[model samples]
Target: MRIFRKITTPSNYHHHQLRSYVSTCRAVVLPSFGGADKLQLRSDVPVPPLKPNHVLVRTRAVSVNPLDTRMRSGYGRSIFEPLLPLILGRDVSGEVAAVGESVRSVIVGQEVFGALHPTAVRGTYTDYAILSDDEVTPKPTSLSHVEASAIPFAALTAWRALKSTARISEGQRILIVGGGGAVGFAAIQIAVAAGCNVATTCGSQSVDRILAVGAEQAVDYVAEDVELAIKGKFDAVLDTIGVPETERMGINFLKRGGHYMTLQGEAASLTDRFGLAIGLPAATTFLLKRQIQYRYSHGIEYSWTFMRADIEGLIEIRKLCEAGKMKIPVDKTFPITQVKEAHEAKDNKLIPGKVVLELD
Candidate 1:
């Protein structure tokens, strides 16, 4: 008679299975911050093991933001220069390939669209992107991957300013400066969805779209004097331009105790200039001075807002997209192999709006 032997399965069996499926994937890496040519396409970038709360997305599409191009051209050198060879993208629309042991919100093969936080190091400019469960949500069935990818980062930024920072409510008046851009247009729609009356400044070409989205007033910044044209005080003002001129107008338009937010926070820029040791403290002190000055003199709150990952906000945005109430039209798209060209278009302002990269 022959001896028989049996072996029990290993305790870490699940992780073993996942790693086998995602040992490596394709990605676009930026070894150094420079022009569009600095971005490189790599075939076998290593995929690290997923943490228990994270999910692995097999990316199909990713939209380019101004941040992506800025980072490529050395925007956050203080933080990013040390961590070179980073994959540079934030917005992603794709299907889940694998989930961590504790992930329950989504299962493998589920279609999802979401964005990473602005400071995330490992981005979505790759075949596989790792995101926490809260950062990914079910994709809106009404939109394609390319179209869906265009919405998240911009919409989330708008949501942060209006809904989270400003606390805008129904029947209140909101002013959005530079409504022709993605974040500005999203703000207009978001405030409208919240049942607030909205007024915005945009170019003549964007007037119809702005009005169609339910903005009560559309003042062309180029053709009209915005201050003279727009009537009455607003409960909140979101200044996308963030220039001295727009900033002054935004603060002046607000009601007492109303909030005024600008997207151009100086935290990162200061850090890039002075390095993290001294720059971070300087940025915080500067922000405090402005906040106090506005509170005392204008009887309003002033803030520098940035995009943050919020699950509730992402789910609500999906509902808006599904209902055809929120959208960001894509100006153009390029395959992942043509990422350089896509980035070049953004830098050159060849396309007026969003640019997306597609992967096969």
Candidate 2:
């Protein structure tokens, strides 16, 4: 790999300018598609040159997401296989080490936290990770790097579903199919912040946490009939568990002209199985058909939502975090050297909540 602007010592980060920056840094690379053992922590991974709108973050903490584990197991092989040796992380919290020439919104030496797109190749699991300008914003002073790292990816996902896709307005009723998980929990809070009455389904253990975060109703899915427990129809339903049965139930719970969105879209799976050429169009057709069918039969909108980098949403999420209103509890933390162990825990479900990787 080509290297440039090499520095032998850590440059002063208290200033707002980066005259020189490190060209190589520590990163966890997935050299091949497989289990956690395939993850290699190398100290000399090359850092790509920043684009005009890019910001280089000196990584402090990154979270292990479900997509990272799935990607390790060859989940997005069609798109990622050829791009082997990919860094596998989405959420990041750290200081701005450098900025591209055209950047102005955020300056060097400022603390920031944000998440990358799910399909990004150059991920955040590095000593220095590249994120687009809008993909990151000022970190909330109320949260640490680890705590800030946990919120963006999960919260942005819920934001995309509730705010972007559903366009939920105040005083509306929202139903979240699975509220125990990070995305579901964040959805509950986002909906409540928007003045929507929130109802959710989860295991009994998560009931308290769900309610603590402003959910009006929490039904234990294992012990109760969801339809009977959730009394009224909803303006929108965000189904984190996209199983056919849950999809049907969520659809039924929505009022006419309401929206139903799911996190598990078949776009990636179809493309992985059928190859991109055939799979891309196939997935589009399938999604269109489902949307049409649901719209015609139930008079509602159906969509597949994914986490995206939204500056406005990210800023609002930061504000919520500043006010102690949004957060995802970190279950366990591992040093960057223990990335393999982190992935293993996530794969075996040993750590049910968020898992983070810290870099010194």
Candidate 3:
């Protein structure tokens, strides 16, 4: 926000004698358009500068997500252009490199992590990244940087989907399809912590891991049909996989007036009423109606959740981690130079847990 000295120079020595030097770092760049394996290696891109309400982070680790793969393949060309040879990543855990004049709360050299909207700022694939002060939270001391980097995107999406849309209540029966995935696993943990009974669908290999994360019952999706195996009506259903048929199957499983939340697909909107709940009733009527509907017929309510990166939300996740209420599932980490492999692993769901990029 404030600049003491601003000059363009070929090297730090040309401008000052004692400026902190952290150049010669490696970063993954998408040179033009290509597949994940082709993410070019660029070693000289300057670490971006800090802005007011922004802090520069010395990235210790950055995680791979589905979006990273898309970005690497030029799938986001419309939104991420004039391309600028962008770096692709979402989750970041690292120490603060520098702070802007107006920045507060986070100080230099403190460890922190969050989901960085790289298209807006710059991606976390680089060794250092400039972050909005509002998008980061102090890292829990109990978590390694790799562990912390794994949670931001998946954990936050899970939290918002359950807390904001489902309003999970005590004794509520919730069904989470695709509970083996990162976001789904996180939802299971948060739901159990909320005093709700959870049932999730995962492959046989992942069933134990899903249960370990707190699901009351793990459905072997490959072996059994979720709708047929789980007979009791649910208060809420989280369809994370969002297959058209999957959504259709889960829709009728909800108790009348119950809510359906999805991370993908637009097939069903939450605004529609089903069964005896025939109107857009007031809050009280809807709650009462849902309670009443549970007594007789099933209801279908749906939502497509869009996630945001918020500091307070990340702080809450940090607290949960410290209390042992949240789990960070990271299966593999690749060096910054191997970013292409990291993206591929995430895209193919080859890793059981989150994938990360380790930086120097």
Candidate 4:
């Protein structure tokens, strides 16, 4: 007995429906930088809109880095201050959910992993993330998402420091300072894979692990002086620990005409405590003067490096993982909800290897 009316749908209804599908997702946000306690889990965080050169990904796992903890505590405040309420993370392993029109290399549903540049403001501590196509590569079949997630940032830093900066060559002798941490561990493997004779310094407990990872010699930094315990000069020195004294000792370990590289900025000493205004020029001049002096006195090349995401370098890492030439050592895995605990663990040095956060 009811009268029927003609049914019609709005022309833009489909578009609205499509938008609803990706409107929002859960994410760990930093409302303001201070401590791990500042990270808040929010379900209504908007998904990053796809840009012509970006790909949207459904994050499966992410790893925490020292940078994450430092960023939370307001480190590099001058550089990251404007990006407050930011998502803090770098390494990501996930499945592509959608791609920008211009993304041709990766298709929807493909597994991928990469290190997000910290300055980009877009981070991996979320249900979805936007990644530039060139920064990511297909994840190796041999690695799980959790394992792959533990790689990129640390491994890329190691690769760049050893391969690009130091130009480590086959049969060359190299010294890696601070060999127990994630970046140090990866450097050990990458250097060995390149056929270099590797020597590293680690805590007494980590000596065996470092040697097991292919280091020809592992010095116990806690128990002995690195400059005295290790004999002979190296073709190159890669210093992951960036203390001024360490940098000086690293130079001493380098052979004439050899390269000395550090992952931390040469100006880190000034920059960490002072703003770039003062630190930038001072660091530049300090390094330049040291380079000139070292060239004349030791004929050594000194370079300071900051890690950047590189697609080709990532591909090399993937190939190494696939070939069993590289391995990611995971110390522990926590659910995304336990992010605060994860950060605390890293801050307290509770675990060795990389700490990972599994999204699923």
Please, what is the TM-score per model? 0.94, 0.95, 0.82, 0.90
> Against the true structure, candidate 4 has what lDDT?
0.83
lDDT of 1 by residue, 1-360 (tens): 111122222466444343324677789999998999999999878888778789889899999999899988988888888889889999999999877777778877889999999888899999989999989999999999999999999999999999999888999999999898999999999999999999999999899999999999999988999989999999999999899999999999998999999999889999999999999899999999999999999999999999999999999999999998999988889999999999988989898888999998
Give the per-residue lDDT of model 2 (tens digit) for 1-360.
234484332243334333467788889998899989999989899887777789999999999888889998999899999998799999999999888766777887899999999989989999999999999999999999999999899999999999998999999999999898989988998898999999999998899999998999999999998889999899999999999999999999989999999999999999998999999999999999999999999999999999999999999999998887898889999999999999999999898889999999
Best by TM-score: 2
**Deviation (Å) of 15 in candidate 2:** 9.0
Residue 129's lDDT within candidate 3 is: 76
- Candidate 1 achieves a global lDDT of 0.91
- Give the range where candidate 2 is weakest over 10 consecutive residues by summed lDDT: 7-16
Q: Candidate 4: lDDT of 95?
A: 91
Q: Rate the local accuracy (lDDT) of all candidates.
A: 0.91, 0.91, 0.74, 0.83
Model 4 quality (TM-score) = 0.90
* Model 1: per-residue Cα lDDT at residue 16: 39
Write down the TM-score for model 1: 0.94
Q: Is candidate 1 or candidate 4 better by TM-score?
A: 1
Query: RMSD, each candidate, Å?
Result: 5.0, 3.1, 8.2, 5.8
Off by over 4 Å in 1: 1-20
